[model samples]
Target chain A: MKPIQLQLKQISYSYNGEKQVLKNVNLDISQGEKIAILGANGAGKSTLFTCMNGVITPDSGEIVIEGKKITKKNKIELTKKVAFVFQQPDNQIIAPTVLSEISFGAMNLKLPQEQVLKRVYEAMEYMNLKTFENRTTHTLSGGEKKRVTIADSIVMQPHIYLFDEPTTALDPLHQQMLEEVLEKLSQQGKTILLSTHDVDFAYRFAQRVIVFYKGEIIADDTAETVFCNNKVLSMSNLKQPILLQIQHILMQKGLLKQCNIFAKNIQQFQKLI
Target chain B: MEKHFEQIDYFAYHSPFRKYSAMSKFIFTMTLLLLCLYFNNIAISCYIIVTMLLINVLKNNIKLYDYIVMLSIPFVFVFFGCIAIAIEIHFENHIIIYVTKQTVLKSICVMARTFGAVSILYFFTLSTPIYQMVFVFQKLHIPKILTELMYITYRYLFILIEIQHQIKIAAISRLGYCDIKTSLKTFSSCIANLFILSLKKAQKHYQAMEARCYTGELLFLQEKQYYNKTTTIKATLYILSILLLKIVLRGQAL
Candidate 1:
């Protein structure tokens, strides 16, 4: 079995001592796991991510990365291993130019200059941002800016990647590109976690799904199991993926066999049909 | 109007002068600005203004009309400012306003000096990108706090402008600016809302930065900018010619 990459122990957080945002949350993320967090707005998904990334220290529990407990003294070191891509590219981008923006995190690591530039260029090539090196960050289109922010995190070469609503403002084409980027990261043996409202995307992309509802984890299991749980879906106010809905209807009509595993994407569905 | 603001940055990225070192440009502009003021002569001031404007337009490919429109923003302020210097006011029971020959000439000199200084600064900004200027400032040993403030302020200006644009659109769609009274009320409300929104955005931005491991310093790789000997030589010759022109035109009246 893969070793646990990150473990959260009864973590809870609140803003300004008001309205507990995350309550007694516990999670064990294995290495190279592709997990999608499904939640409504203000469901504590973002708060959980920030807590894991060391941006917000949990009010009550503890977070351990690679068996190393994160504390105030070593928080920076532990945080360097986790990259959090913000939902808004504008807020994440600190530098004016694309080259500097992507290199901001890598440079912060105090790495050699050559290594920093090499990582930046490699990430840019991977993200197809070679031509946009010197372009002003604000002048970029919404999709392009999103890619830059992803590249910014990629340059850090973190072990775990957390994306907060990565597809919120992306168009279909850009969304496809982001899926490819996520696939590449997963293939590189990095743990990936993203919070999203797109159930269809989560259905096709994530191997595991975690549902957050009102500062509590309602469901955490394989995508097939979580989506098949009607209670979890209703509690989170999330609808089942369209493909899963079709599969269920077919099974109810006695046209399809009930199986433990089901097709999660269009290609698999077509083959099954 | 937003297009005009964006065009300044667009041209800076594409301008031929972008290849030159920002430090060199800064020094050159500052020297010319000081000389323009110290000489305080009309011919020298006009010479500085015309040359800077011509170079920006001809080399940078900026449209003459657009450049004038941008410059007119400062021209309005300078014009009104010159009026105060041009006229003399006297109070004897009632107020009396009069213009003397000396005051008129003095106001023209002040106007010339202001235009010369402004044009030289424009040449620098129209060619060098803001980040490059910030890099130069860092190299000059500016306080880290000041540099950080400068950079964030420059970046947030665009974000704030974009938010303002969206808010204005929403207001227009709701008929919030239909009449004078309504427009005044809407404008005040917009300002109030903008302040709150900006604060929220600032906090979010700081959080985002912290997530990336920002401790105290804003660090990034500065690309090496090499100075070209030819550009330096040309800049030097330009300064010499301006000084010679000032000396020869000291007593001349325009």
Candidate 2:
């Protein structure tokens, strides 16, 4: 098994000492693992992501990245290891122009100007934002702004990324672009944890699925196992991915042979057919 | 408010003079403004105003109507200010108000100076983008906190305006502004809601910044712009002419 890149040990949190938001949740994430955290609204997904990125310290327990426990003194180093992309690009974009916005994080790291510019240009190119370098952040279209936020995260070059509902408010084209970017990041061995309501995207993109129900982890396993588990689905109020439903129906009708490995996406299912 | 802001920003970014170094442009505008203030002479002020007007209209390609509209906003205040200077009121057995030649000349002088100064500012704002000005500020070693605040405030101003626009549209669709009483209530409620929404957004913005490793500094990468020789030469010539015009027209009035 691959070495663990991030470990959350019995983490728990609450807002203003009131109701629990994260209830003694524990998770171990390996390097380059694509994880989709599935949950309904107010299910603690965003809170958990913020905790991991050190934006909000867990009320109890600790988070370790690369064997180093995160602390107030070393939170800056944790920032270097983990990057968080907010759902609202408007909130995340602090700089006036795209070039400056993308370089904001790298510059905060106090990297040399040349290195910062190099990383910014490379990230922009990767995200297809080359033409948008000087465009005002406010003037960009919804999809364009989404890419800018992802590019901003990319310039940080962190090993782990925590994205909060990345696909929310995105058009189909931009969503596809985001998917491609995530795939490339995973290929580059970056650990990714994204909270999303898109079941089909989660099924195709994530190697591991985590179901959060009422501030607790009800299920943690492979996508096939978690999505196929009826109890987990009912408790989390999540529906099966359409592809998964179709696959199950085919098997019930004896139109397809039963196999231990399920196809992750439509292309694979087509090959099976 | 949002439309006006967008139009100015659009012109600033699209202006032909944007190609020049912001430092050079800023220095040119400040020099003209200071000289105009020092001289306080109508000829020199008029010269400055005409030069800026030509640059904005001819070179910057700004529409004449738009330029007039923008200039008129500040001019209205100046005009009202000049009125106070140009006339004197006396209280005796009967109230008396009068305008003298000396007072009229003084008021015209003040008006000229203000127009000249405003024209210089308009040229700078209409031609230089905000990012370029921020770069200039950074180069001048302005305090980081101030520049950071400027950046954040400028970024959010558009967002707040957009929110206000959306709320106004929704209220209109719901007939919330169908009458005077309803309109006043709707406007006040919109202001209240905008305040609360902005505060929440500000908190989220700060958290977002912290998540990206923002310790205390907000750093950005600016494209290095070398001052073009021709542009620098032109700006120098313009500054010298303004000074020469002031010297020639010293103590002169319209």
Candidate 3:
């Protein structure tokens, strides 16, 4: 069994003491798990992300990171462990150039200048940011900026990366680039979690699916099981991934093999048939 | 508006001097400016102008017409300012436009001084990239806060310009700028909304910065510049020529 990297216990929160954003949330995320949080807009998905990253303190209950309860005092330390990538890459970019943007997190870790440089180069290599070392952040394309922001977190070498709508505005090609990055991170045994509205992406990229509805976790299971469940999909206002829907239709028409498992992507769909 | 900035940035990146250390360029321009001021000779000023024009046109391969157009506005401003002092309105009808020989001489001196100083500065601006300029300041051990402010301001200037263009295009698409009254309303609203959104974005940006362990200091990274012996020799030759030219003109004036 994998070690528990993060744990949340009975977390509850509200805005202005009247509207509850989260209610009795309990979750245990293991190390190296690629999990996707799926929800409709205003479904407390972002709020839960904030709670995990210590951006918003839950009104009730506590969050445990690596066996220690995170509080106002140790929140800064928690940031070193879990880095939150904001929805808008523009908001997260604090440096003028790409290299400095990546180095900001390393320098903040109190690392030596040499170590900072090493980490920056490594992250740049990993994110392909070397070509944009001197390019100003504002001048980068949407895809490049998103990659730079991801590099900003990668340089910190955090145990877990929290992304809020990481693929929101990226084109198809850049989205695939992000998918490759996620695959690489998971292979390195670094836990990755992202809240996304793309059902297809959630199904293909995430190993585990955590569905949220009306500020509560309605389902947490393997991607196949969670996506196959019609009740959970309806509760979260999510449709089955198009690939899965096509697979069902083809199977029913005897045009495809009667496989027990649903295909996650086009490649898988081709292989299963 | 963003297109204008893109043009400037493109020129800066392609500048012939972009390969050299920003410190070297900074030193050259500043030394020339001081020499011109110290000599207080119009010949020296004109010579400096010619040297800068040579570097910008011949070395950088910048179009002479573009350079002239860029400097024309400032040149006109200085000319009018000098003329304002030159003109002595003794009476309503007896308006003496060119008052005296002394006034004309003083006006010419002032205009030459202003143009010399401005031209050297413009040469620096046209030849140096923004990152290199930041490098010069960073090496001088300027305050981190100030350099960060400079960088952030420089970056967001383009973003704001782009946003202004977007707003203008959106307004024009809807005929918001078709009439004088509508144009006024659209521009006013656009400016007001920009302020509101900028403030909101500023706060969000601070939060995002904090998320990545931002602790006030924005660390600057350096790229390797190939400052070799030949480059050093060339820089020395250029500096010696400028100094020699200034001295020769000063001796002629004496």
Query: On TM-score, who's better, 1 or 2?
Result: 2
Ranking by lDDT: 1, 2, 3
DockQ of each candidate, alpha-carbon based: 0.73, 0.82, 0.55
Clash pairs (backbone) in predicted model 2: none
Greater DockQ among 1 and 3 belongs to 1
Show model 3 residue runs off by greater than 4 Å. A14-18, A254-259, B1-6, B91-97, B226-229, B251-254
Candidates 2 and 3, the one with greater DockQ: 2
Local accuracy of candidate 1 as per-residue lDDT tens digits, B153-244: 87888998899889989998999999999999999999899999989888888888888888878988765566999989988999999989
Give the i-RMS of model 2 in Å: 0.9
- Give a tens-digit lDDT track for model 2, residues B1-254: 56777899999988888877899888888887888888778888899899889989999999999999999989999999999999999999999999999999999999999999999999999988887888789889999888888888889998999899999999999999999999999999999999999999999999988988888878888755567898788888988887777677666555
Q: Which ranges in model 2 have alpha carbons more than 4 Å from their true place?
A: B247-254
The superposed Cα distance between candidate 1 and the true structure at residue A222, in angstroms, equals 0.8
- How does each model score on TM-score? 0.95, 0.96, 0.92
Per-residue alpha-carbon lDDT of model 3 for B95-189, expressed as tens digits?
Answer: 65557877787788878877888888877888787767887898899987787888877766766676778888998999999999999999999
Error of 3 at B42 (Å): 1.4
Measured with C-alpha atoms, the lDDT of residue B219 in candidate 3 is 64
Q: RMSD for each model, in Å, please?
A: 2.0, 1.6, 2.5
- Model number with the top TM-score: 2
- Candidate ordering by DockQ (highest first): 2, 1, 3
The C-alpha local distance difference test score for the whole of candidate 3 amounts to: 0.83
